[model samples]
Target: MRSNRDRAILALAVSTAARASELLGLRGADLDWGDQLAQVRRKGSGAQQWLPASAESFVWLRLYLEDLGPLGPDAPVWWTLRRRERSGDVLERRPLTYDALRAVLRRANTALGTNWTMHDLRHTSALRMVRSQRLSLRDVQVVLGHAHLTTTQIYLVEDDQEILRRVHQYLADQAEPSQEAVASESTVGYDSNDLAVLLGGVPR
Candidate 1:
């Protein structure tokens, strides 16, 4: 994505797994740089919480904001790059709206030849967290703000393709002998009598 704003938005979405509305509602003051946490407004409850984000996301966010020049802490975090017509028949910098965000994704989907939506980003984030195994399901549940742990357990379901890959890898591993074992085995020639004894026959 050439648009730094879109890049920042995408980075934050996958890293934080925050709802689109939560991300859109972020103000310039919402970030805690020291902890690398972001304050996002949770959907439904309208409550706000801190979300841990990737450092790369912060890099993109800083770049996007730097391009916009200085903004007050209370200024909306996301803004339209192109000046838009506002009330009083004047063109002014406007906060990035949901429609504009959709347009951004539409353009990206067109260029990438993929049909994806903002909600997909949240799914992607959750899957990544679950598969990484660095975070527990409970942690993921908290991050996703699920009312019950069972909601996060949905990710525990194995994907068909992933199961296939793991099975193939295991079969391949089983088919091979450990090099250490092979190296430790005796390679000396055995006499015929010794071979017969080993084969459960009388030594002859």
Candidate 2:
């Protein structure tokens, strides 16, 4: 059960794809616990995100802090359950650090056979936006805090699976046509000359 806590943390980190610094910078108070949305500051660009917390994370955090009672507004969000030191001696109260987070992720990868790095989590987040959510590049740029849309563009992956999915959808839609359905849809009719106007020349 305790091991699952560690696994859950690892899952959340990769799925969120937030920088270690940004993830560590999160505060408990930033969460709307009931709604599972959190306000986070991206590390380099300083952009803020309204990230949706995973249901598991929300539940775990609530249970972990239940005995500690309510936290202050500026309290450190992630706790080490120990003090920082040259040696890994435990401290009672201290904020979780990036170094510690790195160690946690390393263990998680070893256990799961998932060759993931800290930044790969961020990449995973970007991939999730593309695959699962089908978010626009513009939306990804805002969420990932890329300084330029070009930076975000590098992560756009159009894999064979996506091509197949699109092709299947196209074929399915083509196979299921009805005149009544077409009639109910709005039409933007174009003259044959529209193509020439668009191309700025006659078709070769």
Candidate 3:
């Protein structure tokens, strides 16, 4: 909602599904304004790939950048809102360090009453893409910058809650009166003996 630099960074993280380290390394020249693509350097292989970011992400990015003037090619895309006096006496617009990002998330967790990690943000991105059914798994792997397809396949695992929901629905269907029950008027219904095992019931 807010267009602060932190929100811009989060928007890019969720939309692009880039790793926190990869995003932290973003420079002014890395973003393609016309295409809404961000060039990220992979952590393991050091391969450079362009990730498609959402239009809304770029809008927040632009608004965040408006606070700071134009940046040179090598200037970091993300910057700290306030300079820490503990760091040094001289004032400077420092790049958003990994520690600072963690601190931001810590504050967010406090307010949300939930613990969330950067990896969870990536998981959310992957799930959103998979459920949308617009993009293929391979497409997601490319954006996520995963070296192995197997690593990308982790997102395909079914959620436990979904599994439990289906199980409950199946039990409910079985418990309901079936078409056969209506036709025969439960003529084949089990007696108290079967009910004893199932429902612990017996007629006097």
Candidate 4:
């Protein structure tokens, strides 16, 4: 986890949820560098867009690239290198495969002792948009890259917690008596028998 470059790439992937291909396609020029918002073109997308970076992510990405010198616009943003393994084995400098991404995720998850799948990050993002930020389905649709609004709507939920919170708040807000109602009730006070009749109940 202390390997700065790998960690930075992991955080970037988790935060953005962009396809691995799209992410690998990124270049130094694609990033604002100062603001850290990255402009990404999806692999099959006709549109290009910006992704805001977390401050921590921005910091690490800069740190990782600082000594690498100038990376050309078309160069792989996440380049692989033949580095000695923990056991002193050397590997090839090929572009990282999708399998490598999954392996990294698995190792990270094990170290953290969490059951997180690579795709789960996307679901987590959608859930956060709905629950934490209260973003609209349309906003989520664009964010999650869902072509259809209905597909995005699947992330919005009327789950038990949301339902219960709404019900409790509504009841609490209604519980306080209005001054006019209280005064009217006082003026119309009646005997116990009258009260019982008005309530449609016989006296106990």
Best by lDDT: 1
Residue 136's lDDT within candidate 1 is: 87
Task: Encode model 4's per-residue lDDT on 1-204: one tens digit a residue.
Answer: 646677777677666766666666687678887777777786666468777656777777877787455677766666556566674577655566667767777788899998776577666656777775566767767766767788877877667987899899889878987789889988785788888988998975
> Regarding TM-score, does 1 or 3 come out ahead?
1
**TM-score of each model, paired residue for residue:** 0.80, 0.69, 0.74, 0.68
lDDT of 2 by residue, 1-204 (tens): 244435445555665666778777777677787787767797866777877668877666666666456778788667757755765775576677878777776776787888777788778778878666667888778777777999988887888987999999999988998787787674556555777788797853
Q: What lDDT does model 2 reach?
A: 0.72
The segments of candidate 3 whose C-alpha lies over 4 angstroms from its true place after superposition are: 1-3, 81-90, 160-204
Reference-based lDDT, each prediction: 0.88, 0.72, 0.85, 0.71
Misplaced by over 4 Å in model 4 are: 67-69, 83-93, 132-134, 158-204
On a 0 to 1 TM-score scale, where does candidate 1 land against the true structure?
A: 0.80
Candidate 4 lDDT score relative to the true structure: 0.71
For every candidate, C-alpha RMSD to the true structure in Å: 5.4, 10.7, 11.1, 8.5
- Model 1 misplaced regions, further than 4 Å: 81-90, 177-204
- The window of 10 residues in a row where model 2 has the poorest summed lDDT is 1-10
For candidate 3, lDDT tens digit of each residue in 97-196?
8898988888888888989888788889998886666889888887787778899888887879977998999999889978877879866677777778
Count of clashes, each model = 0, 4, 0, 0
How far in Å is the alpha carbon of 13 misplaced in model 2?
2.9
Rank ordering of all candidates by lDDT, starting from the highest: 1, 3, 2, 4
